[model samples]
Target: MGNEANARQLDHHPMHGVLKMSEFINALQVGEHHQQQTIQAYTEYRFAYRICASQLRPVALLQITYVLEAISSATRPTIILQNRPDVASLFTIDPQTGVVRTVESNLEPGSTHELLVIASDQGLPQPLESTAFLSVTVEKSNELRPQFDIVWLTDNGTPQIYENLTIGYVLARISVRDAKYDSELSMSGCESICMKQTDSSNVYLLIVCGVFDRELKNSYNLLFLLSSDDKVILEHPVHLEILDVNDNPPRFEHSLIRVTFNRSADQFDVPRIVATDADHEGNARIRYSILDTNVFSIEPDTGILRLQKEFDCSAGEVRFRVVAEDGGKPPLMSIVDVIADVIESNAWPPVFTKPLYEVSVKEDAEPGTCLLKYLVSAGLHWINLYPFDPYLDN
Candidate 1:
């Protein structure tokens, strides 16, 4: 028979003639009989054939076909959503009308938003069917609003300070205001910026955020400690103090100048020394002095020195010490040194002299009197003798 013909004939047969004679007869006789003997016999045979045929088919084969069909019809698409500063909500759907929803607000900028969707058995017509994903994209909002404002004043008006001036120094007073809301702002970390000032001038603005103080109730005051680079040095808590006008002049911390002078130092040369005070300008003009005697006098207008007596370089070393005082009541004083070296100058010529010496001779003296004489010379006293020792030793 042709293949197509054989397949069609097998479909009508119970087991393609593979059923055992005893079993086939048992199956045929087990079914109900009809009032008409011919019809009842035919019905029983048809039932028995169907029962045998069903046993021949593998149950796993039917399940595999169903699964294959399900996979072929499954639709899976990954969902990606754009990050948003103000994302209202998200929704997901499956083929069987399954739904998932999520909501988010006040999302941070430059951040990603992610959501996962799991299909529940109730959402699917057939629980065993494999499901596909659905991807949806939501655009982000581009609107931005200002959140806060800040204002501050440095304790010394200037942001720069010397290393010595930085110790125990209060850099500045910072005040932050939340224009959006009325509340007290909580400081994140230590609020002080404390470091050496780099340039002659530096300015730092305190940073304040709405997140710090949700309610716009209280204004925040912080001490921003700053280094020379405007970087936060250290933060300290400072009680708000409305400063009063100046009442003091700048002053140096110490007095009793002990300066070393080399013989080479010129007479009446001025040296620069500085003093500091918390007071501002006009109130800080300092005047210096040489309290001892006319030996040294400071230029009243300029701090330059004027020597009354010429310094003696031959006197080994000389000291030109002076005291500085600011123009304040019971004036503040500081002592500073003007070191000078008594270096000898080669510009002066050396002096030479003849040396005479007498030596006793034996009784049998020679006819000519022994005349003994030597030359003595002196160079600049400052010239080191060791360097000329080789020539002198010869």
Candidate 2:
């Protein structure tokens, strides 16, 4: 009605039974003047809208699309009844101009910000319109959870040195609750626990388990401790034990004995021969006996060697054998030669005899002639003797 010649087609919706062709044409020429005026008034009032995320971690701004829709109404021309900005378009806004612009940038987590909207049309030339400033906050989805289990084993209740015990005889049953979901569990320093031997009486086991978060990959360490009571008397890093075996045989330190006796000595003073065995007391039980009867007699249980008859040191040396045997499956026997030297206390003295003789031919020669004289020396004494003929005396 104001300028019918410049009127455009009422190609858009009408409002309040009034033909909006003239208003539309006017708005187009003046660069959306009606909408721009409305935006300016709204900016003076400064409307605020807030957008928040479930988590605080970093995320792509375009990934979250907050759709904004326009509503249709009457009595205001085909105007913007309601306006909203989408989260997907947040990064496309220019911070300096407070208007929607193209931005190929990443948004960091926990970054609080606001966005401004502007008109986007080929023919319209108007100042940017900030429909509403949106405050956005980013957050992560969820927290990390840790999980794991324990296992253990041992062979014998009591162990000794050189004894082999089977460890891992009992296996440890371990399980992690949330391991498969949010965390991971690993075991280390456990190989020793599985195959370790107790080198000392006091032996302990230390097993370590580690838990890591799947998201952060952070590790947490834990230990399971154990102790031994029966086999182990003290606490040590290794296991110890003892084994019984028949590796040593009984033996006497001396195999033979030689003794001296006096002929006049009383039988009550008979000499005793003693022998020892290296084996344990019960295993070392030994019996002694005289191998020959003529020389001496032995008290089997007491191991006493007594002379049957008197011994003289001056006469000669007596030799006798004694035997010692052990009580075993295959009895081991040992023989000792007992030599008794006997000597008389008083010795007899040596005597000498001289022979008397006469030679017949020597008397016819000369009264002064002498037969060959001979001298004899016996032991500590010496004697001289002469021979004469009996036929010369007639």
Candidate 3:
């Protein structure tokens, strides 16, 4: 019993050479004579396993071997790869050392590899076999920098961003190459009103974050920076022009204009109908005209009004419309009412006054508001007073 216990304990030690039947018996005695003892054991097993590799790169990942109990006369397992026909060409395994390595370095990113590995122990009629699944996942690596393919919306030979576009409106699209890796995008000029959005793995959008006004800012010089793994790889410059929109109509300082002139005056200077448009380019160009062209005419470009012919004084007060139109796709316009009072020179007989009288008034003034008061000499010693009402024609 003692010899059998010692033999079993020795079986736990690593086996180096061949074992004989006589080695198991240290001593066996019966009736003062020595006797022989024999012991028998069997070898069976399981496996060890997994590996990881990077895409497009060669790697010798790990080794695989069968896990066996310490026993005498046990043979080392032979390892072999049993994989599908499609992936059989991609991997290789060493039969003696059980080392696993890649056959080719052309693995795609995000691809997973599953290999069935078999290990057979050398035994009598049929060898003991054990199987293990070696899972190898090709992880994507950040090796290449981000590349950009930009598409611009253009108008009249210029990249366009229409004024007053809503927030989140896409202005341009960019196709990115090698976008699976970690990447960052940044914009320099016009960052406050514009931003970048990732639409897909290889697509990106340039969108508006705020309103745009062509009158305030007509053009933008945008610098796009693309980075990979925190390193800047590309610096691209883009020129964007803000297209004009007819959002602002031609505006007149005063909606009503009043003029008093002497009946005997043949050719008198008429006040210019000043109008302004808060737009860009052709949208801001103003054209002026008088509806009553028989009495007055206006310059198309300068907005200067002038008397073209004589009018009847019996009407007392003559009213006309002055139109201001802008040059845009769909033109915008404004009209102001003009009143001319024909004062009979024979009755008033006023004289001696400055060539021009200028005055300032608030934009929000009420109608019939008295603006300017002037004193005029009726005769050598007599004086007359007149009030200038800016809203007289309202």
Instruction: Report the number of the highest-lDDT candidate.
Output: 3
TM-score for candidate 1: 0.25
* Per-residue lDDT of model 2, residues 116-174, tens digit only: 33332222233222232334343333433222223333233322211122333333434
TM-score of each: 0.25, 0.28, 0.44
lDDT per residue for candidate 1 within 44-103, as digits (tens), equals 011111222222221000000011112221322222223233432422222221222233
Global CA lDDT computed for model 2: 0.36
lDDT by residue for model 3 (10-43), tens: 1101112221222112121122221222122322
Measured with C-alpha atoms, the lDDT of residue 81 in candidate 1 is: 25
The 0-to-1 C-alpha lDDT of every candidate, in the order given, reads 0.32, 0.36, 0.59
Candidate 3 runs further than 4 Å off: 1-146, 153-158, 164-168, 178-180, 191-202, 228-231, 260-270, 292-294, 312-317, 341-394
Superposition error at 123 for model 3 (Å): 99
Candidate 2 to truth, TM: 0.28
CA shift at 362, candidate 1, in angstroms? 29
